[model samples]
Target: MAVIRVIYKEYIPSENLNSIVDTIWIATNYGKEIESRILPDGYVDIVFDLDKQKHLNSGNEIRISGMMTKFKKVISRKNSETLGIRFKTGQFNAISNIPLSKIKNTTINASDLFFKLNNSFLDELVEKKHHWEKVQIINKFLLAEINWSDLTPNKLEHSVCQSIQLNYRELDLNKIAKNHYISLRQLERRFKATIGVTMKEYHSIIRFNKVKDCIAKNPNLSLLNTAFDNGYFDHAHLSKEIKKMSGVNPSEL
Candidate 1:
């Protein structure tokens, strides 16, 4: 095991890309190469290495990581920086050429998709030093990928996903389906297609994320308080759920 010092920065996407992209980020690993834990967030990403990529991967090609269903770890490459786009939930299907179902729990070369990544532009991305400049470069590519006519999200996806997030504690698929005038089976089918994970799985991740945020913001906060606050039945319930998502109990953190 080793410690990696990375200057990781995240920026809000511009208004145009905001609907599709959750954040534009830069990760620069300058010392003590460390491994990164990538958790399931029900979203996908496109990662570009700013410096010539080496140790962490076989080639310098741009890569796309699909929605992770569980935790995955990656070793940090020494003296490298990454510029990436974390797509918003349910939006990857619109921008990516690859099917969400095919990519679950794996990463593949962007060339695996229908569109050919421009080599000339990739050269430009490597030459840039400032993160803001890299963001603009990525934004241009994403803007072209957007389907201007299809600006709206799928109705069932929007409603069901919103309901899950809105009530992270009390996720009732039956109630949600009834409320939306769709059957549970229909919503499950749509959820699996629109997003890679099942509705129950996605809800669990969302709830765990909420608990993580709560703890991250208030380190001194008690586990019992954290559990109750995030709609868990009790500390024991929170512990079990956290372990499922992160492979560790809340006390460990």
Candidate 2:
């Protein structure tokens, strides 16, 4: 029998960045090499790696993983620690000036943007003995470096993002536009500019992510039931969408 590889993940809480950051997770993969599929959840992240041979040849420990449209396959080496910050949708812009669209599908060096920290920050973060200590360092760094100007919103963009996130699968774009009192075209443009994906795309991701979570957590969940609960037309429809988004069958996932 093959030994199952375990990837340990610990989520650290942060009251300071609660509004902008969704999760601060520290993970380490143990045992043999493993290929883990990362499903998109409509969020961007900043990852700091203690080991970086697979990330880039440039030897940069920090990189930003942008909003993803599809599942990303990541091969993890044994015994490597990774610390990451998952940002809430539309919140990245509140801290950085870079257009979300530019990095939509790629991971880039954090240095490309103007965000900065103490030179010893990464070293201090890695040397921490406990998970919460690292989270504290990160939270303080972000709170000190957060560019307040980016959080300002001019119109309904903030509310719109929240509305879609709250009602992703069942939301009617028409109704949202009406409630926001913006033309459909204007809504599309704003979503593209702020979210890097159109409103429809974001909603689709949310729906798929929900199902992915369900399937992973609920062993007794039937495919047909999962489809019905998530608003898919049927199992066939769910399977097709899953294939398009994750390039794998529902069973494989």
Q: What's the TM-score of each model vs. the native?
A: 0.87, 0.86
- Which regions of candidate 2 deviate over 4 angstroms? 1-7, 52-60, 115-120, 153-155, 216-222
Q: Please name the candidate that would achieve the greatest TM-score relative to the true structure.
A: 1
For each candidate, the alpha-carbon lDDT, in order, equals 0.79, 0.79
lDDT of 2 by residue, 11-123 (tens): 64567677788888877776767888877778899888855454444345788898888888876677667889888788787678677878877888887773463235666
For candidate 1, what is the lDDT? 0.79
Give the runs in model 1 whose Cα sits over 4 Å from its true position: 1-4, 53-57, 118-121, 150-152, 218-222
Shift in Å, residue 224, candidate 2: 3.8
Compared with the true structure, what per-residue lDDT tens digits does model 1 show for residues 14-112? 788777889998989988666777777777888876667552345545788877767787777788888788988888866754457677788887756
Instruction: In model 1, state the lDDT of residue 211.
Output: 88
Task: Report the number of backbone clashes for model 2.
Answer: 0
Q: At residue 57, give the lDDT of candidate 2.
A: 46
